[model samples]
Target: MKRFALFALFVLVAAVLTSCGLYNSKMASDPADVETVAVVEDAATEQAEETAEPVVAATEEVVEEAKPAEPQIFEPGSFESPDRCKNCHRDIYNDWKESMHAHAWTEKWYQQDFMMAHHETDGATDLLCGACHAPIAARTGQLPPADGSMFDETAKRGISCDFCHTVTGLDQMYNMGHVSEPGNEKKGPRGDGRSLYHGVKFNENHTKADFCGSCHMVIHPANGTHIIDTWQDWKTNWYGEQNITCQDCHMTPTPGVQETPGRAALLGKWRDNMPYHGFVGASSYVQDAMGNKKQAEMAREYLKSAAEMKLAETVAGDGNLALTVEVHNVGAGHKIPTGTTYIRIMWLEVIVTDATGKVVYSSGLVDEKNHVDPDAVFFRVQFRDADGNLTGKSWRAQGIGYDRRIPAKGMDSETYQIALPAKGEYQVSTRLMYRSFTQATLDEAAERTGEEYPPVESVEMAAAQTRVVF
Candidate 1:
């Protein structure tokens, strides 16, 4: 009877252990508390399995709540006109009124190129070019007519306040990657301001370099060639390393960082620095053509402050004049003439004269026909087409053929060798010149559009003189 009782106790213990193992296995199959309990039959193990179902459901609920929310997209006619914003933001609106952004879509020079590209590509480049130029039209599906006939009044305003302030996110780094969410919610760099008409939200992107980089960096969609590399160049240079953004320089009236202490809107809070919205660049010619004198002067100031010229001279006994001119990019954050370099140009103009003031040598002089010397050393970018021929047209670019622009905080030197006819303390003068658009570009535009444009004037960026005696 004693042996039978001991065997019965052992069998009962084995059955309890087997039951505990089964319960633990079931808990493991569920999504919760599998590792919290062991297979040994204990009070804690029983309690975990009893509460496992609720924990599993709660875990699933937490995961479902962690997913990101979908972005808000607005339809056509949702964005407000610039005139409506001017009621509150008078100063900012005035600054943007004469800016390149304001004339991006309406400018004659841009329309010429855009129309030509449209015709050549059979409307392929309509959306691509208009994405940044006429952003509202592209986003609203008012484009593809290759003209402004289908656009609304707000779409004709170009890069206006509502379009820029309503940007929600970016899909990429180049080719107008900005995503817009047009509504009563206005996004900006600051959020503490109170507005009766709309809700304000702080967008960190407005304070970052990536905001301006989206439109400035242009890439060819078909061939993957970089058409405009301003953003890319700035990103890889010392300015990007130092975290100096485009807004820091371009948004200010002059070059470098200058704070304008004021309110963004008339009813907004006063701040230590409110960004100037002129967006000044090396487009003084465009501004002048558009009859924007203030913006043109500011653009000229920016160009003048960008670089400095230095002269190094050596004269040999055989009357050989060897002059080296170093062009230093002093103020610009990226390369000199950063945007649309194919259509813009910067070159060195050197002139040497004797004591009698007779011209001995000259380079980069504008001819009677208003053209620079073909053999001049041009600091610009050019690309190669599919046939491997060099071309200045951005739409025909397949690969880079020539790229020689002065980098930020960098120096580029060119040495000229000229034989002196008679040397008696010869005076060497040099000027670093910049042109907004090449004469050839405007000539082509005139040929295509049947409109006459004034000759592009050269802006003197920097000058230096030294007396070389032999």
Candidate 2:
């Protein structure tokens, strides 16, 4: 009986292997010999069935070939409006309504810059800039009329709830490569929650830095110059090495890492930390200009926490004072003034005052016309055009010409030599100031659009004061 069982098991194994095409794969290649092989296989099967009496029959399961994934197709206006999401996510909607993402497409400053690029490049930059600023419109093919005349009302909302939650995948790391899957199924960090209106599926990408990096990193398609490098800057920094993501900092209301306990939706399960939708950064100027006072205050808090300044001064017998100001990137996970460094400006302001309350020396002070001193020590970036001249216009960039930013946990120092007229307990005050844009940029925007913008004010990021006696 044991020998019979062994023989039956061997026959079953051979029959299974043959049925899987393992034995016939090589023989089937020759069409002329196919008939002979089929006849021999049929005779062998009949013989096996006749001899192996107790063997059970089986059939092979056919495997289908894998095809490439296609892009998610949706009709225009398929993405739901932010107002619809407001019903279940009131607090989040309120925060997002005034956030930069909400105004990304409608913001005047961005529009000014985008239209200028469009005119200069003859609409080459239209798709590039629109992909991030107006993603719904870009994906739905409503973007060619760059003025947004053809855009639906939902597309005008700009990076709203459905747009982000429906992101299925990404095509690349830069230039807004986010893939959209607009439907009833929503993807986010947590998928277990039950919703009456839609299906919630967990997406690991929603929690990773790459989700934000897709839009944050911008590379010029024409010359491959890195226009915005906030994503790469953080990826290579110490925070990134430790796996701290942008969502950890920017998604919170404050500067550093802190948890806010709440439910993501009004009817959803409780979460240890629900992401703050304000998305505040160094945008106090834009926030205040747009009348988002609360968001502007939050942005100022971010600037205040980003860095700290220390002053060191030496008084020479000849009345020559050498004051050194060191700015430390203590709070920000990436470089100070990380995104759009070309348009934004960070600089050192030194003011030496006499005991009599006289303003003896001042650098980096805004003039009557609201322009920062051109010769001030500025921490920013400038791109080099084809002619090698420095330009702030990102669309014209061929390469980086100048870059001086305080890296995460790094320090930058600048020394000022001032000859004291009569030094006696002179107070030296140093401040690290930041501005969203220069007065010159606003002036240019006003010139091109005939619309006046408010004066750009500098936010004091960090400050230090020291007294020197001679």
Candidate 3:
């Protein structure tokens, strides 16, 4: 009867264990834990040779049950500060610190734009815009107000280190499809690396254009308009079929090549290649105003590299000069000015001077109020509002008015007619110029901040000079 009671007691204990879920399902998913269990069991068997085998086996099984699985994820607020990443990767950290990605949320211009869009939409697009600009705050449910009232200290970091490395995968190409876990297991290009602070895993998505496209492509929530189609431009173009991702251009020593050799971490070992963290793009005006000189220069270099300008055709006849200036999109895979195209400005500035240094004609001059000349051939997306009036505010846009931006590997031959009034050997100079903010928008931004605002910065992207003999 005692033997029968022992068997019944053991059965009851097993039943209770099953009901209480003592065996974790997550353990099976963890290969490291499984390997640990196997090693422990084998070691226990080896020790059992000199002791009671049954007792040793039972203890080993209990030990295995008590061992916890490796953590794969963390709660939203558990992200490490961007400064923490600087402790090891100072170079990358410094580079990223000055980038627009780092300033995406914190930039005053973006904040003003967000507030304006939210106000225009009656708080409808608060989350839609914030999802990309302030992703951490948006993911944590602090972005509905879009006034940045609910954001925490960490969320204000914008696209900080932890938020990016924690991204496991992407779901789609639009509307914040980046799925991040926000934990110590930082996914990057390094897989064999073992860090003192966090687990390292290789995530190839970091090197893909699709990943960048996931956030870079923005669509309007109200009218279902493709507000930002930078990614689509690249994906459907020659570059995408060639497998040249966005990382190849924005993160490389030379745009479109992917072999940047350096150490990604402070491991005292060299990696085959390391991508730059500057995230360089065509944001010279904005980056300069943000007090990031190096990044501004980098952005300037990128813009300069994006286009090439030359006099495709020139005519000097009948006391008049007609020139066809060819502007080619040589470097960029998408349109010249891709994101926030309405607010951004890209135009052709042409000037004709006589041999005696007298200005005969000039186009694309900035007015006293910092506005570009209305007659300049500006490459920008135009929009119409609900009330059928032209508007630059994207949230109020009902339809596209016109898209004059140059496509990738495309050319825009602009014909300028100038009257050769007493001209002796007229010299023509043409440049493609770009600026992020216009005077009207900057005025509103200054009014909102109640501080001294930066003057409108118009960067010359490309230049061409030729002398037309009349």
Candidate 3 similarity to native, TM-score? 0.80
Worst 10 residues of 1 by lDDT: 35-44
Per-residue lDDT over 1-470 for candidate 1, one digit per residue giving the tens place of the 0 to 100 score: 00112223223322332243322434334333221111111112232223222211112232233211222234668789999999999999999999999989999989988886665555656766787998888777677588889899999999999999998777667777787878899999988888899989999889988999888977665444667878878988999999999989888887898898989989788889899998989898989988898888988999999999998988999999999999999999998877888778888899999989998999878888777766566787766555554456666665566667798999888899988987487989999999987787776567657999989999999999999887
What are the runs in model 3 whose C-alpha is more than 4 Å off?
A: 1-76, 253-258, 314-317
Give lDDT: candidate 3, residue 92: 85
Candidates ranked, most accurate by TM-score first: 1, 2, 3
Q: Indicate whether candidate 2 or candidate 3 has the larger lDDT.
A: 2
- lDDT digits (tens) for residues 148-196 of candidate 3: 7877887788888888898888766665667777767999865777789
Minimal lDDT window, size 10, model 2: 58-67
lDDT of 2 at 184: 92
